[model samples]
Target: MYVAVKGGERAIDNAHAWLAEERRGDKAVPELSVPQIREQMALAVNRVMAEGSLYDPDLAALAIKQARGDLIEAIFLIRAYRTTLPRFGGSNPIETETMTCDRRVSATFKDAPGGQVLGPTFDYTHRLLDFKLAADGDVDDAPLGTPHPDATPHIMSFLDQEDLIQSEPQGAETPADLTRTPLELPASRALRLQSLTRGDEGFILGMAYSTQRGYARNHAFVAELRIGAVAVEMDIPELGFAIEIGEITVTESETVNQFQGSKTQPPQFTRGYGLVFGMTERKAISMALVDRALRWKELGEDNVGAPAQDEEFVLYHSDNIQATGFLEHIKLPHYVDFQSELELIRKLRREAQENIMQEAAE
Candidate 1:
């Protein structure tokens, strides 16, 4: 016989306390500080910030540690914390041209005006696991190289100067935040790009691969990929003048896709853009490709029912946090709902048995 499970609330609270304690792990060892995590687990922090839509590496690192390395949970924490923050006002559109870049590359041109700076990447590193770091990791304290002042201009801008590529007019109005508002169909460029940045790396990569496999084949060239820190400023109406709020590291990517013009316009090259939190080149690149693929409608191309072209499909499925929550929710207390289904089945079986007996007696 089933008895009522008692003290669920208390059990949950106690379990949470235990989890927090376990996350810290041994009082003598000293708690892992946010700065330590940010410095040590830089990549993990970057991923969390990129997906979380908040670029505070320290906070992201702290959340990661608190969640015991659950990246999605860390993202959730950052998202939740971000909501409590008051919006004073938005700042002028960032001058991306003024960005002091660490890494910049273009696949479109052989050699652009600004030389390609392949700064600090795993591209050249061999995939061999380091066995020396089994006891204590070798910490390198190498100083960084001074950056070139005259970095390369955007490839798209160069193409636009020749009227080969379509030049997008700067949007005067402040774009709506996807986080504040519910997502709707037929999204703007800002909304599309925002969703793609926080999207799961693997999911976006697969979608990009699908495009290459002729799903929605649009000839795309990586116009530019750059990673750097940009100052994030906001206007305070009370002060009546904008002040420097903070700075954040970001990865920006733009792709030029070949397209045959519609009935209205002539054959021209279209563009796709991606701006993400931290130095995540791969995500930014994938985002740009997917963004271009999704723009088939605006560009007057036929919808071939490709995965990337379907906005609903990509936006809804790309986030790991959403997928994971739903998937793992089944492991929670779903027994009550199961009991109802079980009861219904039992009732149906009893009714069927009675009907059979009646028929047999007749």
Candidate 2:
């Protein structure tokens, strides 16, 4: 519990003022505009948008600037601001199959139907820092490639045709919105996905890595990983039809796990899916690994007691906003609680001394 320490209004005001000054840094350097952050620091903005559970890039950029490039703080700001906004009707599920992919690759297949398009990526880049970039040297524009004429179909669909992979039937039931409702234990796969997508990248990555390191090795193979823009649509009650609201860039990872056959069922490959906002391929891949590990029960696998498999543990601790809030609260005044503990300790020590003295007299 927090004790309200009174009479530091001036100090608080001064501290805030100083913080603003510090955020600006050297007066010689120009201030970072929101557009500059949105365009240049696109990855950071994407992370903020993804974790904040808000799609507004401009607002995310502004939050980043306000928080002085502290992503968690920016996410916190975005989340806080999101709570104040009016809720419109939810958008229809985006069709990733119809996505205009900027980058698409499949590890399972050397040559896929759409053909592999390796878009802007750091996969082949040398790890060494470029002095030219540091000096803000002008660079040549990236050469554009000819766009694919036809829409690329999912790689899993090919596996499905051969009956090689497990089928994922579309659920008729509307998923529970964790934002509107409190997160309950024994969450559905939909809720778990929601939590995972918005979870801390670092925490999720670590959990996913643990699975890879034999915590609960699922033998995941990236069936396909695609980064692209998909149109977001919402059904209009007045029009009785869905219309495109906007488009959002997203990274999708689909992993084919090892075959888990049962006595009653034939052997078939399982699936783990991850879809996140922006070009966050690393987080998307990590999310897929963790997602597969968590599906131990549904897949009729033994509970290995892995940390990732524990639904309650993963969901409860995944949210960085909630985690940081509880953690940072310790810095606030807890004078009464601390004083009570101090007094109890002193009283116990005094009683112990008196008891020793009595024993000596006897």
TM-scores for candidates 1 onward, in order = 0.89, 0.96
**Deviating ranges (above 4 Å) for candidate 1:** 1-5, 25-31, 135-143, 235-243, 350-362
lDDT tens digits, residue span 228-341, model 1: 877767777888877777777788999988888887557888988888888788888889899999988877788999989999999989988788888987777667788989
Per-candidate Cα lDDT values, in order, are: 0.83, 0.90
Error of 1 at 153 (Å): 2.0
**lDDT at 135 for candidate 1?**
52
Q: In terms of TM-score, how similar is model 2 to the real structure?
A: 0.96
Give the per-residue lDDT digits (tens) of candidate 2, residues 268-304.
Answer: 9989989999989999999999999998887778878
